[model samples]
Target: MSIVIGDIAKECITVDPSTKCQNVYSMFEEKTALEGIVVVSEEKPIGLVMKTHFFQKLSTKYGFDLFMNRHIDLVMGDELLIVDYSIPITEVSSLAMNRKQENLYDLVIVTKQNHMYGAVSIRELIMKLSELQIRIARYSNPLSGLPGNNVIAETLQEVITYKRFSVFYIDIDSFKFFNDTFGFREGDEIIKETAVIISDTIQTTDNEPSFIGHIGGDDFIAVIPHYHYEELCKEIIFRFDRYIMRFYTEEEIERGYVQGINRQGILDNVPLVSISIAVVHNKQYPITSIEQLSREAAKIKKRCKNITKSTFLALTE
Candidate 1:
């Protein structure tokens, strides 16, 4: 589940609307770090009063003499933000950042089902947002700018929850040979270009909400609708095969292979890279968990790779 405001909201002090300014000031003096207090009526937050604003009013020339005895409602800030406790922290951060400049430091009141829940500080909200962004970045493949292995597992879990979707585990064949001969820079470019090809092909198709994740290097995973899974796979392989040669030399392109040192230290010719897609759809197989889906896809991927061509193999029955 997504992180919500209630996860970080702090318990706040509340006072009645009829509470005098002098009484509110006393509360502030007791809690030196308290920035604001919620003004509630019948256990529902109605307004907010920032300690600085209240003290400023009291410190004015002859101001204390006039409003010290007056009710806090006389100087309380009415323009306040009240958010549902279940709202996403990221969303709340956006709302807080967009507040009026002068009132930006004000506390945000949180409510649950129309009842006062608590309050959130803008500073805490920002910190949570920053942490979320860092986590996303950490799980993203730097080369392809696509979500990496960690996100792939999470996405698979979510797709499995729906109990109706196809997972395509994609891999590039003979990729290591190309990387060995072409060098790391060229290898990185191929990975980046492959990501673009997959993303672009998916966009051209009318499959909405398609998920494409890179599992680092030359491997990727995609969550697509079951209806058009085969057609989409064909498109990806065709586009990749057509465009992959652009990164190859004229001789390698004409000869259809590149020469590289094999793992056994023997110099030999290696075929150009090809894509292998292993498709597993819950419609045909009952996927109870991400582990089952991954294990099945890996099994199918090995079979697809042995075919010596860019192709996709799907689970049948």
Candidate 2:
């Protein structure tokens, strides 16, 4: 997808470590616009050679006589940045920013399963990241800055065809009462905190990047591989319970409840804000469409509402 770093990569020549430096120089001469070349062994990238750096080395005193006849690996940059083809531009950009000062402008070697695929210039990486930010700004939720309803719907549709995944419908319990009593400002802080909790927990628990979306106020959604749904749920709850205590006063925390109006229009003592995650997965059942996905998650969410404190309910039977 256009969201990945490889989508913006430029094709570059690959030379084995044993290739002569002069041959690499000739390849650069043939492609005037070429910025770099990847040095590979058995198709796996071992180093990168920037055209400017190569020329600088060759132009040095005795540089031509010394390196022109030697193997390219002798002059190749072993400290280059490399990333998987499917890595997100955001992640790769961070990796690029942290490079040594001298290697800051080097092209990033893009690979698939450790095989050199292409190179991404600094200019191309910047441009693609700018485009991604603009797109997110247009489609993201204003409050949490997570993907909004439209993006969530699209993600759901995309994952509907997957053979195995768990779609989590995350709801904040008693959020309306908390907001009404504490004011919009406090409510906003809670929303942002919740977003961070979900995002961080999922990131730590999963090896691959999980798709998380904000479905507007007090609700979020995440689509991840079917495995470890229960473990993931427990982690989310544990983090939320520990962190949520900070938002309330010591007295209220001690009391374990807040006075607020109920949905039935009567005054009542509403419990402190808690989280509920209703997970619907297709590991055992066939989830044919978005409609089926929503129906199953909705049923689980209803069950989750009846539970107290932070908890998770998964569709198992």
Candidate 3:
């Protein structure tokens, strides 16, 4: 049994159409997932207002004071895209995507008849689709969706618990030049493809369970049980280097391309996509904490980035 729209939807946040905008903003702040509030009157859904509308109104000539003076009805979206509890998750996802395309809201209110029932987020919809055996094209970078720093912390924690592992921090050398030359989207695709390759390489071996995490942008981390550290890093570097070459134009690959210097005075070039990797085997140092292990791995990663002109690998003693 697949998860359905009704199974995943959160209870809807509702407000009277006459509610003051100030109150709405306060409530919205309290409910982080409250993308939009459904306006109801006399037990019937009437309109919808979103936080973006509130922010836009805030930036007007009146600014924050407008919240005190205006009613939600004044800012509500009149034409709403809503789903019923009975709607199939697939149909709900389509409706949600259409709403996102037409408007920037992240959620849609689900209702029964005219009364509000619940709301669904795009994240929830995607998860539901995955559960239903549907494969949607994921736009997020395969290595690190947002490439936020939290992934690094999580990887370290995993190592702390497991005790005997190797941590490899990987970076692409001269990625900025490629981005500058081929356009950012192409650079993004290359990064995504690189992430996929790195992930696949690390997980392929039959050694202890390994983890691959994106540290955002061009940085990635792979955790392998101590037994497989050597083989995994070698495989990752080999596969990543091979795959990266395919992303460049033949001329650019052959002749290479130079990039303008930034304020940092580093000569930028569209060189062959190479990776600098720092590997640390936990059994040797036996890190007692996640933070210390992460700091050490990051330090080594930075060192690899600094000394190597192209691709380099360093292992912690």
Window of ten residues with lowest summed lDDT in model 3: 134-143
Candidate 2 residue runs with Cα over 4 Å from true position: 161-164, 246-256
- Tens digits of per-residue lDDT, candidate 3, 217-243, equal 787777666645666667767777667
**Global CA lDDT of candidate 2, please?**
0.85
Global lDDT of each model? 0.83, 0.85, 0.67
Question: Quick one: best TM-score, which candidate?
Answer: 2
Per-model TM-score on C-alpha atoms: 0.57, 0.88, 0.49
Among the numbered candidates, top lDDT falls to 2
Sort order, lDDT high to low: 2, 1, 3
lDDT, candidate 1, 1-317, per-residue tens: 23678888888999998999889989999999999999999989888999889888889999999998989888899988898886767667778889999889899889999999999888878888889778878888988988888878787877787646788888889888878777889888878988998888764435544678898779988876555688888989999898787877899778877777877889887778889989898886578898898889888987987776689998872
Candidate 2 pairs with clashing backbones: none
Q: TM-score of the candidate numbered 3? A: 0.49
Candidate 3: give the clashing pairs.
147-216
Better of 2 and 3 by TM-score: 2
Candidate 1, residue 265: Cα displacement in angstroms equals: 20
Q: Model 1 segments beyond 4 Å from truth?
A: 144-147, 151-214, 217-288, 292-317
